[model samples]
Structure formats: C-alpha cells, structure tokens
Target: MANFKLTISDKKGKSQSKELKDKEANVLVGMHVGNEVDATIVGLAGKLKITGGSDKSGIPMRGDVYGSARKKVLLSKGIGLKNAEKGQRRRRLIRGSTISEEIYQINCAYDGELKIEEAPKEEEKKA
Candidate 1:
C-alpha cells in the first residue's frame, strides 16, 4: 500500500501536515458521489465541510473540499477539535465514516492543497 503525506495549508498560505492511506488520497482528486475509499471521510460531519461558504448558484452546498489535484482534504461534520459542538443535535445530516476524527481536518483556508509527492522514506544503515 502507498501513503500520501499531505501538506494542508490555510488561506494565508500557512501549512500543516498529515498522512492518508493510498485509496483515501485518491478520492480527493476525484470528488464525486460513491467515490470514497476506506479511511475516507464523507458527508457534512467533517472539518472540510463548508462551515462558511456558498456555491455561486445560490444553492446551499456543503461537502468535502475537493480541489484540482487528487487532494482528499477536509472532513465530514466539518467539525474540528477546536470550538466543537457535541451530541445528536450537532449534525445536520449524519453518515458513517472515520471522517469525523481530528486527523482529517486542517483549519480552513482560502487556499490549501495536498503535496504532489510522498516524503522520502527513511532507509536503515547496515550494521
């Protein structure tokens, strides 16, 4: 299995890092329904969910922050560990996925994207 070390950035161009399993990383590139793999977060419960934004069409749109590259970022619940609300009252729509975890969410930014290549893996020196 391959892993992607994603560098998540915020609107100001500041960045943070995280890792995702191979398949889950692919979903971010292909943002469509029925197109998430294991470890993929979906629906309105993740951090990448639009806490504040709207589609130009004037319709209420909320979901993952899909970008031009296959960067599967954001989260369901749009919920971050910071300033979070709990209980059944929290969800506008509830769906099941590992997406709710904090590991998935980086703070929202006007501009953020996943790094194109995996960081170099370390090699052990021979004794």
Candidate 2:
C-alpha cells in the first residue's frame, strides 16, 4: 500500500497532516477537511461535521465524507460560532474515477494539493 501524505486544514485555520493508503486517501482527498459529513439514507450525499484533531496530532479530521461514522467533527471545544462558518453542501461524485479519483475529488473540494510530479528521463527500451 502506497502512503500519500495528506494535509487537512480545519475551520479554525489550523492545519494537520496524515498519511493515508491509496484506497482511503482516494476517498477523502477532495473533501473539505473540517466539515461534518454524513451519508444519505438513499446514498445521495454525506453529511458534514466539524473538523477535529488535537493540536499535537496531524490533520485532526472528523466527519466521514461518504458515511455516517461517529466522529468529533470540531477541532476545539472552546470555539464558538461567528469566528468561522462550516458548509453543508454535499460534493457531487465524478464519473469514471478510480479509488484515487475519490481522493482527488476531496482535495479538489478543499482546494487540496494535486501537484503533478515530473517524471525523470529514462533509457528507452530496445524491443
């Protein structure tokens, strides 16, 4: 399993980092890092909750993007409204995407990094 580094920023403007395997990372890459997300009974959209993680943890994330799993959602217990606002809009799934595609989508939603690494030149094969 390849580990892709993830940087998730919470609503309070704090950011966290984590390493996800290809499959799991793919599913979360394009979602907003700190929004609460829940699954629709009919499977239309996932709910969004607060983004949570301790200051010592990397990418303190909460709220599952595709399903209703128990999560903290919020980062701070003392944080109150007016300082930040969370969104509830569900992300529309893209057509013809691999597992990586899901991560791509989540990152896209949160404006996550999708940098294309440049490939190094290699010797051509002689057939």
Candidate 3:
C-alpha cells in the first residue's frame, strides 16, 4: 500500500500537513505535477493542484520531467538547484513529475474555502 505525506497550501500562504495511507494514498499514485486532485478525497472542499513532491530518498520532482523515475538533468535554476549563477548549468538528480509508490512527500496548492470537520475523539465516542 502507498503512503503519502501531503503538504497543502492555500492562497493565504498558510499550509497544513496531512498523512494518508492505503486507499487514500493510492488515489494520488500516477498523478503528475500540475494535475488536479479531488479535494473530497483528502478531506478538503477546494481544488488541490499537485505542484511537486519528493521521494523517500529526498529527490525532488520536476514538472518538466516525465515518468516516475529519477534522472540527472542539467539545471541552471529550478527545483533541484537553489543557488545558481546567471549562466551556470550543472547536473542534478531530480525525479519525474509523476507520483509513484516511492514518493513520500507531496506539495499541493489549494483554492476555495476549507472546511475540515474534526473526527470525534475516543472519549467522546465512548460517552
């Protein structure tokens, strides 16, 4: 079963993290960066857009790249490289845009109002 840690961000810049397992996580598999996810599946009411993600090994996903495999691409500035010269290019390891079972962290942008209902606590349930 696939497990994923989702980092959802809103227009206000506030972000929240959610952990999904099994079926919930499976819904995200095969989705690529720039794809829209069903907010209902993740307990949200707005639209969730996949921006980027990283694997368990910390390799970042790049939208320009295809498939779910990792590759060493020469970059001047982008996800893989933070500090770059005006005209500098270097080979860096980057994962493809597609989400796979190996991906652990997913970054998303949310649009629309968020209304998450809290689940009842164990004590409340017992009472």
Candidate with best TM-score? 3
lDDT of 1 by residue, 8-58 (tens): 444555555566565665444333322323322421222342122122222
TM-scores, all models, native as reference? 0.24, 0.24, 0.87
Candidate 1's displacement at residue 39, Å, is 12
Give the Cα lDDT of each candidate: 0.34, 0.33, 0.91
Better of 2 and 3 by lDDT: 3
Ten contiguous residues minimizing lDDT sum, candidate 3: 110-119
Regions of model 3 farther than 4 Å from truth: 114-127
User: Tens-digit lDDT track for model 3 on 1-127?
Assistant: 9999999888887788899999989999999999998888778786899999999989999999999998999999979998898999999999999999999999999997544558799999999
Name the lDDT of candidate 2.
0.33
Alpha carbon deviation, residue 75, candidate 2 (Å): 36
Backbone clashes per model, in order?
13, 24, 0
Instruction: Look at candidate 1 and tell me the lDDT of residue 55.
Output: 23
Where is model 2 more than 4 Å wrong at Cα?
26-127
Q: Highest lDDT, which number?
A: 3
